[model samples]
Target: MQRKEALDILHSKLKKKNLVKHSLACEIGMKRIAEYLGEDADLWGLAGLLHDIDYEEIEDAEEHGKKGASFLKGKLDDKVVKAIERHTGYIEPKSTMDIALYALDPLTGLIIAAMLMHPSKTLAEIDTKFVLKKFKQKGFARGANREQILACEKISIPLDDFVNIVLKAMQEINEELTG
Candidate 1:
């Protein structure tokens, strides 16, 4: 399916505002990583955007990602499907983009949570130091899934480094989403 069509489907299917924001965050984060790595930004963005396409379908949250992958098979590239599948912790990624997507999926939630607590409640006002501090605090956004956020290290980049990359990327386009 075309990226636009997939995105439409995503918008229509995902009703929760938090889930939609998380999807957008992952898309922006993955696109930035792709730009930095000289990979296909659109492909990365599409993968990130559709990663949890079937998240609300499966009864077991644990299998949602994997099921989403299977559902996306033949509709998207194998790599894209794989990235979606592993976003939920069911599998390991084999490429830089996949690894970045996996690492970014949850990290963006934590970053957003941190940004929301700020006086401005905007990504433009968030800083790496603040995100890092929140990342270390287990009490903050307890469901942010630190383990998945730490998975960015699979590509040899530290958690803070990945956070900085995603945060900076989001800040650059904060107006697009926040406005």
Candidate 2:
């Protein structure tokens, strides 16, 4: 499906503004990471955009990805659905795109949490160092799985570089995220 159609479906499924912003943030991260890895940005962005499409409707956190994939079965590419399925860690990521969505899924939340803690409460004020420090702190954004964020290194992206890439991507869409 087209980006517009995917977004329409996302809006239809998710009523929480925060969840939508988080998906948008993930979309930005996925797109930038795809460009960095010389992959298809649009496809990666779509996977990230709809990764958590069923978050509100699914009561089980472990089932979110699977159910979302089922919800998007024919409307999106099979690869996109598979990537979304793998994002929940229910299955191992087999493709570079899948690895990216897996790695980015939680890092976006950690970065956003770090940005909120910043004195400026803006992406511009946060950096890789701050985010890394937060990453090491188990208490900070406990919901953002550090193990998942560390998965970026498996794809050959160092933690610092991964943090920087995601940070820049999210920064570009700061207005939309924070608004």
Candidate 3:
């Protein structure tokens, strides 16, 4: 399916505003990482954008990735579905692209949390150090899933570096993100 079609499907399936925002953040984050790594940005963005398409249908955290992969069986390509499937951190990310998605899947939520807590209440106002500190805090966005963010190390990029890269990209598109 086309990107817009996929987005429409995602929007229809996701009801929570915060969830939708997180999906978009992942999309943008993955897209930037893909560009940095000389991969297909569109494909990466779509993978990130549709990663949680089945979250509502599969409430069990253990089965969410598998369910999402199955849900996109005939809707998207195999690679895209694989990206969604492995995004949950249940399995080790085997590719740079997979690592990118895994890293940002939870990092995006943490960044958003940091942005919301900032005085400016914007992505641009979020500092990399602040986000890194938040990552170490057990009480800050507890569900941000540090395990997934730590997967960034598999790609040779430390967690702080990964967060900075994603946050910078998001800052450039903050208007589109928060608008």
Mark the regions of model 1 whose C-alpha exceeds 4 Å error after superposition: none
Residue-level error in angstroms, candidate 2, position 24: 0.2
Which candidate has the top score in lDDT? 2
**Candidate 2 displacement at residue 76 in angstroms:** 1.8
Which scores better on TM-score, 1 or 3? 3
Return the number of clashes found in candidate 1.
0
Candidate 3 lDDT over residue span 1-179, tens digit each: 78899789889889987778778888888888888778888988899889998888886787877887888888877888888888887765677777788878888888888888888997878899989888898999998988878888887787777888899988877886788
Looking at model 2, the pairs that clash are none
| Full-model lDDT, candidate 3 | 0.83
Q: Over 4 Å off in model 3, which ranges?
A: none
Local distance difference test, each candidate? 0.81, 0.90, 0.83
TM-score, predicted candidate 3 vs. hidden true structure: 0.90
Which of the predicted structures, 2 or 3, would earn the higher lDDT when compared with the native? 2
| Clashing residue pairs for model 1 | none
Task: Highest TM-score: give the candidate number.
Answer: 2
Q: Is candidate 1 or 3 superior in lDDT?
A: 3
**Can you give the TM-score per candidate against the true fold?**
0.89, 0.96, 0.90
Candidate order by decreasing lDDT: 2, 3, 1
Arrange candidates, best TM-score first: 2, 3, 1
Candidate 3 colliding pairs: none
